[model samples]
Target: MRVETVLLKDYTTLGVGGPAKLWTVETPEDLKRATEAPYRILGNGSNLLVSDQGVKERVIRLGGVFQTYDLRGWVGAGALLPLLVKEAAEAGLSGLEGLLGIPAQVGGAVKMNAGTRFGEMADALEAVEVFHGGRFEVFRPEELGFGYRTSRLPEGGIVTRVRLRLKERPKEEIQRRLQEVDQARKGQPKKKSAGCAFKNPPGQSAGRLIDQLGLKGLRVGGAMVSLEHGNFIVNLGNARFEEVMALVRRIQEEVPLELEWEVWA
Candidate 1:
């Protein structure tokens, strides 16, 4: 176990957060020990935006043994989703190709049901092993209440492992599908960002609405709406959390449309 004061921006993809009390746990025993303390679970920092004021709560990040997995589809929560997709494809497992580029760990991905138009984490998830109430417990997919970019997993619990059900498929076919998905994602901005800023309202695309309103390229401090994709708020350089929120608020207030934030602060 490692404990230190770390800048949130240094851990997140957005690069815009204050310092936080970070605790690194490398094993399930360590994680169980940590549940007795006040802490928030943090994954790979792919889909989060911490506040500039920072957080008083301690942060726990799974690592070491948590990043390891077996070919039987039993994976530790800290395993990278992209790596899983690649390994699964090579192993002729066909279920995670649509999520090839998502930069999330298994725990966060399961928490958010992260996915694309092709499929979601819930599609292949059989069960989740979580550290809760000072012990480990397994919950089935139906218990999670998986929905679009959301889940009903209870709070105050940390995911420890995930079981997936994948079918056998040709490696070449999986690679081709992965290539197609990658090509489709090219329009997303390459700037420092936390992917999409808002959830699509029902069937409507938040990006399309923002683009239609000509909000692209709009800037607030070092934060700006991506010209290539309106749904993305990119950090030009040295962006502050306030600047990103300013842009987000402006879009919500001016667009006269309901926008649900995808970035968590």
Candidate 2:
């Protein structure tokens, strides 16, 4: 493992951020050491929003051993979410169908409790493997206290892997369901994006609210509110972090001012 300075723009799906002090780790030993420093573990960079000023602390990104996937009992948190879901589905495993469109690694998904209409990671997660204070621990779902778009993984605790308990279903049925989810995702806008920009409110959808406010196609520099899905902010090339932030702020401000509904960024 080595530490270096890397631009966050290249790593994040949004393609809008400054350089960050970066560190790359692979083995559990490396992770244990990195956790001792002021660091943030980043995976896939899907739901993350880095400041224009860039992340100040050491940002640790897992690779090599950390990215390996094992479905027997535990899976690496750094493994791609799509890959994990695909493997599960192929093995006749149920659950994780709604996460087909989500672009993130397992660790990030667990931290954010990422999910969609069908179900969430919390529903399938049996336990989470975490490294903290130079030791590893496995926390059950109840201990993690997962909820809507959030989890109770303590701050500074680095998720190393996740153990998921899946049910055996018909292989054909699993593939069919995966295809259905994938087809639904195709209708969304095609561009570089960080999935959804804002979380959905209690009752209303964020995309619907943004569209109702006539914010589709709205732009700030090269960042634009996705015309197809208002909840997504897409980068049209050469977009800056400040532009995305500005657009988010505008949407948050206008949605409440015009619709009397508060939209948190």
Candidate 3:
């Protein structure tokens, strides 16, 4: 197999990290073989934070073969989430429109039950095909034990594909909805960021709470909280992971003391 060292900054949306050991797998066999050694499966690297010293573990990245999309049936795990949603919408399939601007791969999205106002990926998932241990198995939505931002697959299990059942909708309606989501996302600040930094706690929004506490546009080094939306911490270029982490910690500390609401990381 091929192996290389890569700057995590180049792979992650935050654009801030050091080097990481990387391996790319194009087939299930390759994945199984790679898993014989210790490794972590990575998607588009949208929601993860690599340490300042970089990831100490080998990172397995699925390639184009695993990224395939079959709108009529199931989609491969490596498929880009936004691309899958776009393809499904263009094919007149409903249920993934609300995920329009979210950056992640199908495998990562499914693992986290990614969703928006319309609904989550779990809502459309019919079954999941996974490679675990040395064998493959299929799991229905109930069997997958889907919950908020988590799934049942064991820590090292690799998701191969997912069968989604989407409703048939008018293409025009689908396009309009996607456009609306896009418009809403565009209204947010444009900068280098890791999307949302923390999950909303209980019934309250992390953004609103952070904003209410007057943390908007707050800065630590080059990392700053987005003025457009408080929950997002944007990189103003030349920002480092340590700086971002420091800002995150500051938010966690200040918000609770100032507003009496605990924000999670």
Q: Which candidate leads in TM-score?
A: 1
Whole-model Cα lDDT per candidate? 0.86, 0.81, 0.79
Tens-place lDDT per residue, model 1, 73-104, is: 67999999989998999999998988878899
- Stretches of candidate 3 off by over 4 Å are 256-265
Q: What is the overall TM-score of model 1 with all chains considered together?
A: 0.96
Per-candidate Cα RMSD to the true structure, in Å, reads 1.5, 3.3, 3.4
Best candidate, lDDT-wise? 1
The digit string of per-residue lDDT tens for model 3 on 1-265 reads 4679998888887777778788888887788777887777778877766666776778889885787878877788988988888788878999888788878888888887776655777888888988887888898889888876667886567888988878899999999988888887675668988777777677888788889999998999989999999878888998877788788889988765222111112
Cα-based TM-score, every candidate:
0.96, 0.92, 0.92
Show model 1 residue runs off by greater than 4 Å.
256-265
**Using alpha carbons, what is the TM-score of model 3?**
0.92
lDDT of 3 at 53: 74
The regions of model 2 sitting more than 4 angstroms off are 256-265
lDDT score, candidate 3, position 76: 86
Candidate 2 lDDT by residue in tens digits, 1-265: 9888988878888776677877789888887777776877778887766766787778899886888876768788889998988888888888778788788899888888888877788988888888877788989989998888887887678788888878889989988888888887776777988888777878878888889889999999999999899888899998877787788889988865222111212
